[model samples]
Target: MNQVIRGLSVTTFFYMVTLWASFALFHAIFDKPFDHDWDLSGNFIGLFMVSVPYIAYGLILRHLENRPVRRAVQVSLLTVVCERVSIYWIGSYFAANGYGNPIPLQFIRGEAAPYFSIPYIFIGGIVSVLLCVAAAGVRWRKS
Candidate 1:
């Protein structure tokens, strides 16, 4: 139980930091460079691409910790959903459960959601995790 809580803390904190860095880079490189339309979907998709290896790294660490390989993979995949949800709504949740008129939710609900095109982030999150696992499996087979 304690280990799970610690693991969740580590994953959440690591992901949040990476997410901020990613958003900063994306904002600077895309949003400000040409001053074109801010493509929030592009940022979200690109971040998922960037996050894959980090997700794999966490899974590998879990493996190193003597958790079963399958369990590590399973939890890592679940963490993808967790990470995405946190990215999307953590600020709003902190503000006041969507009743307090959160500023962050404006970007999240207004910009990101409509920009995503795909109606379900959960599906995308699962697919991203599967891609990471597939890559890891192939690498393990080769080495």
Candidate 2:
């Protein structure tokens, strides 16, 4: 029980920090606010931020002592929910503060997630699951 909570908390923290740090990096490098507009740099940063956290999360779970494979997968799915909601909340925060375009927030809030980002989310989830599975497979082969 404690382990599951710790896993979720750590991964979610990674997700949030990664998201914020990417935006900060974009603003620093481009000298402009990140407004959810996918200019060339934005596209790369956005995709990288969306996908890397899941990989990191899966790796963390894989290395955690005594973490079961099933629990790892479950926590990965939960992070998807966390990611989507964070997008909405964080985008809204940016919009409200005049740091971003509200158009993206309108689309996200109306539909529960930006339509364009859904595929990336699934890809991240799939990668996370694959990492978990591969870790278990290696253990099984040794036994």
Candidate 3:
């Protein structure tokens, strides 16, 4: 019980930090902030892509040390799916209330926007995985 709570807390914190850093990176490099509107679904999708691996890393740490790799992967994938569902629910809540100063839906045209494109999401995921793996390796070596 305690372990699970600790794992979740650590995972959530890491994921949020990574998300913010990725947003900042995009802002710095692309000279644009992450959009707060759904017409830019690509951006939100990209954020999710970047987030899942970090969440998986936390689950892997909690359950993988003594378990088979296959089992660990399965559990990690499940954790990612659960996190995505929760994110969707939260997004819907915010959208319903016009939170984050979302642009009116009526104003959005159907053209696919470049904000939060797939490539950025993939880059974020790769960077996150590398960072998490490196951190874990360092901790292991220290101990």
Identify the leading candidate in terms of TM-score.
2
> 5-121, model 1: which lDDT tens digit per residue?
655566566666655566566667566531234356445545554465446555555445554344446655666667566656665564455544466644554444322323436
- Which residue ranges in model 1 land beyond 4 Å of their true spot? 31-46, 53-56, 81-107, 111-120, 135-143
Evaluated against the true structure, the overall lDDT of model 1 is 0.52
In order, the Cα lDDT scores of the candidates are 0.52, 0.60, 0.48
Q: What lDDT does model 3 reach?
A: 0.48
Clashes counted in candidate 3 amount to: 1
Minimum summed lDDT over a 10-residue window in model 3 is located at 104-113
Per-model TM against the reference: 0.55, 0.59, 0.49
In model 3, the clashing pairs are 43-116
lDDT by residue (tens digit), candidate 3, 26-79? 667666544544335456546554655454564456445553233334433444
Q: Is candidate 1 or candidate 2 better by lDDT?
A: 2
What TM-score number comes out for model 3?
A: 0.49
Q: Rank the candidates by TM-score, best first.
A: 2, 1, 3
Query: Considering only N, C-alpha and C atoms within 3 Å, which residue pairs clash in candidate 1?
Result: none
Candidate 3, residue 43: lDDT: 63
